[model samples]
Target: MEGFEIRLTSSKKGKGLFATKKYDQGDVILEEDPLVSCQFAWNAAYRYLACDYCMRQMHYPPETTSIMLLVRILAYIQQSSDPSAAIAKVKQFCHRTENEDAELVHKLLGEQFTHQMNTLREMTSHVVSGDEVQEFLTPEGFCTLMALVGTNGQGIGTSPLAMWVNSVLEITMSDDERQQLDLFIDKLYQYVEEESGSFLNTEGSGLFQLQSSCNHSCAPNAESTFPYGNHRVQLKALKPIMPGEEICISYLDECTLQRSRHSRQKELAQNYLFVCWCERCSSQASEPDCTSEEEMSDEDIDADD
Candidate 1:
């Protein structure tokens, strides 16, 4: 907040954070701990030594990773396209931004109907008292919470082993000492893998107040990192940025960024509901519109989140 201000974009794309001073590549523009954070059940494995990064990254595992839209989240329970009328049979719930009737979840979490039933029953059962009950606790509340986390929760990747390696490399040491240490590290990992067979630090996601203000761009000038290897995030400049420039981050991952204009546009629209107007997308205006080489899935979005 010191060197940046939240205000409306000149392009009228709603509010965004703009630089109050210049920033060089690799310079930290901002650092923030989450306003509120949560651990997913999968993150329970974080107690293990081999962090989540070491485990083969799962691509598009629908059961654990896909994000469902509020509208579609409701439809799974509503069992029909008329979500508003459908929810009236259960309880009053929040309306959708894109449209009340949209079935966007068909593309994201199409097979989560049973998951919703179980989650709603389990989640609502915990309401100990009416005084403590929040409005977001009905069948619709399940949809609201899923959509909220999907849209806003930022993923946290942490690794203690990586920290040890970085610290060892930072210290001055003889070449022979370095070789010995490298061998020791390799053997240590091998030993751990053999013993644990399967181990990982679960990646958790969180919501950050200030960091969330940074808008999306196909070519983001600044990016978020977790060099300290925890939930805390530091916004670092990817390229030099001058005063008055808007700091942005990509909502998609490295693989997704290389997608066609149409493919990129489709994901952004589905996730964020706005077509990206970044320079990279605009420059490729003439590219043929089609689906991506690999269908964009919740797994891809999860990687970025």
Candidate 2:
């Protein structure tokens, strides 16, 4: 994290990140690790091979991601010895949506998610046995975790070449044992060849504390990326930003930029529970019929994917 500060100000957005000083275009503004990183338990059916820490794709072993995520969560619970603290941290994220049906929508989603968590707990019970994890297995705790992840999670991708190299080095043996390992090596190479081309296929989601506070902007001055190819994300200035500017990142895709103001607002309201009042949205309101090509940019959109 660099050149930014968090403050509770009188701004309509409430708490947000502001520039500490002027930053040039392309300057890295902030870098941070997630408060919690987990595999998309809902997407286990998709069978993507993501990194356990960053949720980026891996090449060698596809089965490790989901199991590793469970292991990490279990380890956190064991080490902290207080599951309530973890739940409290997750509760800090915003889960309110401004949609007309927001309450009903949240209730339905929470119930479904709670059931899923319970099912996951049962499935992993054999491997993860302890009272610490059990404390967080209540219906209420599961719902809280789901709400936090739904509102704040960010998807990350990793490089396949790096994962492949790392996987190869993990297996080693003495000179005499090398002969015995030949068959295993040959099969491993075969698996690598079969899985080689789909390097970027792995994707996972996580929650970042500071990044989550940055509000939405259709024409944002800053953008976020996983520059180190892991869970650590970097927020970079898309253009020169002066001190006191509210750092914003888009919460919708390029396609949203192509839509009219009403349509954009509708999507944002439904998904993020807020109405967009950014510069572009304001301009569009004045020029209802104008389809400005400049409105669209490679802005990162945040939502449950």
Candidate 3:
């Protein structure tokens, strides 16, 4: 963490994280394990939990040890209010425990709770969901969604879970957190391919990691060529960035229109706690004519004349 820095840099709008050192094309940034890696399971006492989309089961064992771990993960996900806050809240509603408390759980799990939580949040948020899946999985769109649930995009929007969760759970965003998230989320649209094209996993891998210093963007300055074996992420320069420039990657797929992407970013910001000022957000503010109706009407008027 010394040679590398996750330092904030100046931007016209606000602040963004950048690399203070010169990072080579395939340099390693940050790597860690997932906090909660339970397989998809249903009717395993961890019931009512399933993949956000597809209704696929998220496997989990029901041994005493596994139950303890699952309880702790549910607590962490609930208390921290990360992107999985909605799902966490639902679990809490169903789980009414007499002896369990947040303080006791943290004491038992120790740093694993914090470390894995942050790392899981980062890896899931930044590395898993984008073109990385296209590099690794077939039936590419499913890979993207799978990678998405594996990250922050999980169990929220675009799922039947939202209807049930929304009815029972209330997730509120503070104004400041919402603003910061707004800037961070708007950029994911520029990097990921939209058609859900196929990604070939040259090697079988489940995990990937990136340097924490890399900034978040919809249109990122760098792209990752993901490797197999836990899907380790390899960074590549997408453009000719100057030395000391902050390298960034999109946390979401790029296969969406600017309006759709921006709207999602706004929602993510309110949910995840960061404002997005990525290049796309910047340029889109100054550019014109993203409206489809306007272009269609102009064509009709021209034909009449």
Candidate 3 lDDT over residue span 1-305, tens digit each: 43334444675322334555665555554443433333223324434354322223222222133322333343444455364553433232211122222222333335464453344344433433433222222233222223222222111112232233344334567878766655654443222224222321121112222233355677776765432222234456666555567777765545432344445364335333356666677667654433467455654774584
Residue 204, model 3: lDDT of 15
What lDDT is reached at residue 167 by model 1? 86
Model 3 ranges off by over 4 Å: 1-3, 9-17, 24-32, 35-213, 224-226, 231-236, 257-275, 288-290, 293-305
How much is the lDDT of residue 272 in candidate 2?
59
Cα misplacement distance, residue 18 of candidate 1 (Å): 1.4
Candidate 1 lDDT tens digits, 165-185: 778888888999999999998
**Best candidate (score: lDDT):** 2
Question: Number of backbone collisions per candidate, in order?
Answer: 4, 3, 33
The TM-scores, one per candidate, come to 0.66, 0.63, 0.37
Superposed model 1: Cα runs more than 4 Å off: 10-12, 45-108, 111-122, 125-133, 138-142, 168-202, 290-305
Worst 10 residues of 2 by lDDT: 295-304
Q: Residue 144 error for model 3, in Å? A: 26
lDDT of each: 0.61, 0.63, 0.40
